[model samples]
Target chain A: MFFRVVLGMVLAVASCGAMAALQIEITGGINQGQAIAVLPFEQPAEVKVDVAAVVDADLMRSGKFSPLPRSGMPTGMAKDEELLKADAEVAVTGRVYKEGGAYQVEYRIVALKGADRGKLLGHFKGAAPLDLMRQAAHRVSDRVYETLTGQKGCFRTRIAYILRRDGAPFPYQLMTADYDGYNETAVLKSTQPLMTPSWSPDGRRLVYVSFEGRRPAIFVHDIFTRQRTRLASYPGLNSSPSWSPDGSKIAMTLSKDGQPDIYYYDLGSKQLVRVTQNQAIDTEPTWSADSRSLYFTSERGGKAQIYRHDFATGKNERVTYQGKMNLSARSIPGSNAIIVITQQNGYRVARMDVDGSIYMLTTSSLDESPSVAPNGSMVIYATVYNGRKGLAIVSADGRFKANLPSSSGEISSPTWGPALDK
Target chain B: MMLMAVAAAMSIAGCSTTSGSGAGAEGYDGQGVVTGIDSDGAMTVGDPNEVQTYNGPESLREKNTIYFNFDSDQILDAYVGTMQSHAQFLRNNPDAKIVIEGHTDERGTPEYNIALGERRARSVARYMQNLGVDVGQLSIVSYGEEKPADPTHSEAAWSKNRRAVINY
Candidate 1:
């Protein structure tokens, strides 16, 4: 499908030598985030920063809700009737006050569905230092996500993406930001490409495939200790590293044995176990929560589609039937649904239930890499937006939307960080 | 001539090895040079028809590589004609094959580029396959930026290095 598009692209590129980036990239979870509205936290106090806007973005990045912009509000947010009438499932109300060089925030969320029945699902109140307002908002969204999906929310989760600066010898820099694209910090930088970033289940360490040694190898970097170790460099292909849910093993692709296949490496035992015995392309492997099976895309089925290989029976069965081309498959945190790149009409992220039925999330041109939030309520993967390495978030059902166009550079292979409980 | 023959044979075989200790040449650099010359592209030395061998005369043939921009896996038009020639060669010589090795300029994430490079090579591989080249003779390897065309640490040099090499 990508090849077919290439021909059309030739004509398109020839017509407009400058084919601007027109896609957005979002990576999160797949509860199919809710589109709740947050009326700009009434910032009566002179706190130059817009905390509510940050929180709104935080919620959007989780791929949950398409927050209604305050500018588009037909009326003021103070009236509960207007807030409820906004048609958004939920509405946020908050007020900030200065207390002796500190800021106090009190917020509440109303469920529009229960308004007619005189029942309110959310009544949250918290007050902390001004700097922690973002964290406070995340906590609120975490509650909103949980209330809506019955599962936990990934608002408190982190995301790791790469940023390439213009002049740096190794423009590729690894950075971690909150789920809402805030609090970005560059973790690693080099002129060489740093890639395939993954998070440990505990959220304390990050493992990525880096070429610092002139060959692709898996590296586990401890966030607290700031120490990193090379996990594997399997002679040929050593990339696409995904951690086991238990944090004991890493499922990756290696061609050292000849032909691309799935392999699992035990962290403690330092032993390598071969998983998929395939001669076709079998890379990008993700483990089921139970860690009993591995999900990947293989062309043995005539074309690349999602398939499952059980560890016990070792039987590999094709799971995706909707489209011929499906490359990226990320299992929703606690659900049987897997979000993947399906090529039905074009390259876009689609979700399939346990049995393998495609549900296209983005109606855009190119959407790759689907990552779910810790809650499975939101899916945040990377896609191009207007020629930049932008991010997009879509609700599980593929309705809510928001675009986070990075002002920096191209961004890809985004891995949703687990809940930041630590 | 014998050393050249060995290099040529390796290229003719289209063996893109991640490690070079098998080359037997003491000073072999992992840059794919093996010894003194680049074994890719137009120039042909040993038997071009030979298909397989560790170090045969076919290795001396220059490999056709398509360079890419930073962090991009999209195949450019500049490489289309080259891929067409590659397609023609593989089609003419049914026994002959090509392994598209994707490489990225050292500017993004290595894992992403590994995937990016894989996407690049696979793009070409899939394109060639779509053009009627048999998939069996075609294999792909994404070195990410592990193997660069130019070892020097410069933007211009890195741009040239981020390329997919066609071997065989």
Candidate 2:
């Protein structure tokens, strides 16, 4: 089910980019996608593995191009000439072998007929259980996308979410895994409870809500160090801690002011300034790319909707009105669009042009908490699956969809980290 | 808040109900605040200098607990009526030390349940404080949703779990 959505997008992408970027034979109908082939990989001493099929699956998810199947290739042509005769604009070839208890794989892209001919676009060597065979494929696919279209691809990004375990009493933990739902790791844990796992801009740490001592408090945990520090413990309520773009401060919702309202706390100064004084439920704060304005959901208008608050002017404006309830609003980087969860006939997540045009993402699901990737190409959010709460990610244009598929009991409230600094 | 409301109503209920009849318990249960009855149905609640006392009912010995609504930290309206007796007992015994533990059901996010639990505990603490218990002497801790008196996954179990127990 997930593969099909992405596969459809791969077709759309291949056509769009081929028409705009490549001066290929543009037919009366949509360009029938760039036909790409995967030549058998080079074998290193002692390691013999070819990962052409994995690359095929990776690229097809982008709705970009259809890879000529392994069975379709006639066995005799030279690797170079075979790709050329097939009209393949780009070719993916890789080498995989095992050494020192780890798998090493190198991915490459060779342009068949273009200005940049036989280009060694990308190379990655790593260990396995990793879907290395698959990621190796995505790396090559990304290379082709970048080499021809000149734009970065988000196939390698990972998402972090909160999951409840099935142990004696529920254990809520923060989990981080790849976009394809592989290689998962627990970021934080709690016996009392945990919610809202948000990633730092640099992807080095996580900030989330925890009930460690039976009080709703926020903790900042360093992924590498495995150490955590309490950031807030107000007497009444402290929640929805969100990081500013520059990672300087966190904007959150605190009810210590007699009612739930938006508040901004300076990470450096240790001072908190109440941002929203309304007596209504105001929460789910997110930052604009520049950190100049804050977007959040407030029920001041009688129902939850997206609103913008400018720090410089101390003025506010309503940004979403099409839905009766627009709880989560996250701005996609480099685009004027904000992914928000709207409840019209039913609850669903949609990407809306900051002004108002909405592109519905999930058709049937109880979706909430949408977080846009740093690149703004995809949005990850929380929803229920099989009656088990979980997280879902989809391309910004709604071309691809995937569930984090946590082994833990259920998952929710995911926030995308800024790209990994390393 | 509902807890405080409980303590207030308990005091009001004391005036309406006649003195209770129970061995060694009536004095602390249904009695008034100023002059408390001892276990013998005698005034045990004394003034500040005398460790002031009140006569409580024997029935209250089994009812030291309070109940909360589903997904709510707010004390139930029924609690105010019963808690008024507790406020009277506290007034009668100024030196008595009491602890309130807040709890919640298994539903909702854990963080949310914890917050809801604290509010429920505070509700009781505030009520007691308003009814003349020294704020400094009263201590409150939120157990969040950690310990449940009943382990059933049903709403019945959850309602019973969302509670604040007064321990002296």
Top lDDT: which candidate number? Answer: 1
lDDT of 1 by residue, A140-223 (tens): 667766776576766777888765443332345677777656666556554355777889998888888775544567888786
Give lDDT tens digits, candidate 1, residues B1-168: 112333322221122211222222233224332221112111111122222322212433453778777656677888788777778777888887666678776443333346567767877888898888998878776777555566444568778888887776
Best candidate according to DockQ: 1
Candidate 1 Cα errors over 4 Å, as ranges = A1-37, A42-46, A55-91, A98-102, A111-120, B1-101, B104-141, B144-163, B166-168
- List model 2 lDDT by residue over A1-422, tens digit each: 23322222121111111011111111111124466776555544443223554456445434455567566564322355555566677776566656776666665566777786665555455554333555555565556566655667666667777665433112455667665455456554444456667777777788877655445677787777655677877765667788898988888777676656788889889998888888666777888889989998876897667899999999889999786667667888888888887876666889888569887877754676677866676677766555555666666767555554433355667777665522
Q: DockQ, in order, for the candidates?
A: 0.07, 0.04
TM-scores for the candidates: 0.67, 0.66
Residue lDDT tens for model 2, B46-142: 1212211222346566767899776555667788866777778777777766667788875543334444666677789888877777776576666
